[model samples]
Target: MKINKLLILAALPMIGLTANAQDKGPQKNDFTVAATVSYNNTVMQNAAVGTLPSYNGFQAQSTNWNDKSLQVGIEGGWFFLDEWKLVLGGGMSITKHPGYSGVPGSADSDESFEWGDVPSYGAVADQNFVQFNVYTGVDRYFKTKVDGLYLYAGARVGYAYGRNISFTDDEYNMGKSVGEAFNVRGALTGGVEYYITDGLFVGAQVDPFAYTYNRSLIKPQEGLSNLDANSHNYSILAAPTIKIGFKF
Candidate 1:
């Protein structure tokens, strides 16, 4: 009798839980939290490459900062219609762009590269970048399921903030300096998710966007007054990103 009562008491709580779960209907959410990793490639170039007074490639400074990066951000929104989700999200990507110390021309500047593996223009100075991005997008979830899988596609537009590369030559005490630039870009993404539990899901997302910047200051000649400082065009701004995050 004692064992029977204990089992009955234990089962009573589970029964109540099941009943409660059934009574709550479907889950309705107006907000969501997202954390993601983004792989970006930044490229900028002179709009008038060979036609202008500036260096052919000197439209703006370029960095691999948006290269392969990681991002963490949050999103919240309302579900206006059951078949469509209006989602908004923002995030910051922190990355370690490989610094070039040897190769000049395409790799870096000819400012301060003195003692390195490749050659010497000045003292070997490193070049890199870091950035933060804010994004907003809307996705349409398909109303079909094979084994509880939902497909979605959306577009994102936002701003990116980062610091340009700067270095000085110890030989002539000349330092390279560039101003910070905030640029705008857009992304198109699509993904599929399978719910393993009530609030736990796993999925994949991809974004292809462009990253750009302005041309910074570079000392072309060594202490020559009659000579002019030549500005080079930046590289291209285009990258495809793959992402994985969560919803809470």
Candidate 2:
């Protein structure tokens, strides 16, 4: 009888563990990692206005912090509570614009290009951009009626650095045009995730909207003076991204 009682006591703990393992809910100390990426060739609408003047050789240009065409990111989070997570992540973005024709032989004075008013004398004009960002945030998750489905909302704040370069035809002998920009950004994020199986999930997320403050310094060619500009802007932006995540 004592042997049977011992066996039952040992099995009780295993039975409890099995029951706990079957519960597929977020728990304290659970860690998760996820990836987000997107690609599109479409031009951005409502790009930030440039600090430099629009000229034949120099087009008005600025960083569009919300542009997502060229983006790749990875994030990881720790569940401090069953319903709340602390997350950290970073991303990179890039854009390219090509083939701008400048006015013929209009820029004759040094001051013309300095104020960004010089007419272009080159046949080839283009601009390219790249940006990097890192962020941290907290997310709150809520369980729905359906099993393995959770809805989440969060807020994030991050810093971004962006670089843009304008190119003119070599024959024009114009100075290089480059703009270096920085942004302080914040956004609200929300998403729905459906766990395909325990510890694995697929979901979609979007920022819904965001605000950014931008500062840009323009070097409009080696000879011309540098320009400083700042802007405060709010944009209605929703960039939806698919996600795959694992929890342990």
Candidate 3:
């Protein structure tokens, strides 16, 4: 069911591609609105478990860990001048481990295991992670001389919040805390868009460079106060983005 939903979302940009081509793309005073979708799969390596509980079960003999997510976003832009646009947008992402069982050698097994298979597999509930962000930016399009094609570049600043909540047990006896993070980020983005018609187009973009400041908080146990962690990071962030939209 989930895979089907993701497949549908991924195919959105292809819907209007067969429309009649427009003689020109966006011009001054034109407005653009778009929806973006993205997916990410990240492989995680071993990490130090400093000062944390050394519980066994799922954590024992860990072999692999992966983080996966699907995101949806919307944006609106105003062509304030020829070849220049002012944009504002926001997005939300949901992360889940549909097939991963935090145990060694079980991640790729075709056999499905139930919670009863492992007595200490309380961590199975650690499947949901969610994030949201909003941003404002400017974009520039360089004429390519080729009809229906344009090169794009942009810069944006955004604020984001994310949380991962899990349980020590399925019941409320050992309530879990939310692992939460707040981030302020900036990025330089570039892409290409081709107008299928005067008002419709599809494009792909990437954040080749980005900077972020993050503050994370988590509680060790049900009744405990949160512990704080802060960090500054710079990297090429995010997966390739797919966008579909209309300009008028």
- In order, what lDDT does every prediction score? 0.47, 0.70, 0.66
Q: What lDDT tens digits, residue by residue, belong to model 3 across residues 1-248?
A: 99999988887666445333435688999999998886432212122122354333222111111133665667899999989999998767787744223334333333665554543332344446787777899999987877789898989887767777655443422345456667677889898998877899899988788776767666556666666666666767455789999999
Q: TM-score ranking from best to worst?
A: 2, 3, 1
Superior by lDDT: candidate 1 or candidate 2: 2
Cα shift from native, residue 33, model 3 (Å): 1.8
Over 4 Å off in model 3, which ranges? 1-23, 40-68, 92-131, 163-179, 219-225
Candidate 1 residue spans exceeding 4 A from truth: 1-28, 41-80, 92-130, 164-176, 207-248
Candidate 1 local Cα displacement, residue 201, angstroms: 0.8
Please provide, for model 2 over 1-248, each residue's C-alpha lDDT reduced to its tens digit, 9 standing for 90 to 100: 99999999999999987666457667799998988664221222122222335543332223354544555568799999989999897767788888556465455665555555546554555677887777799999999887778899999887767787776655544535777767677889898888776788888887778776767666667677667667775755455678788989
lDDT of 1 by residue, 30-126 (tens): 3444444454433222111111133343333444444445544455544555546676655454443332343233324456444553553434534
Between candidates 1 and 2, the one scoring higher on TM-score is 2
Judged by lDDT against the true structure, how good is candidate 2?
0.70
Order the numbered candidates by lDDT, best leading. Answer: 2, 3, 1
TM-score, structure 1 vs. true: 0.48
TM-score of each: 0.48, 0.60, 0.57
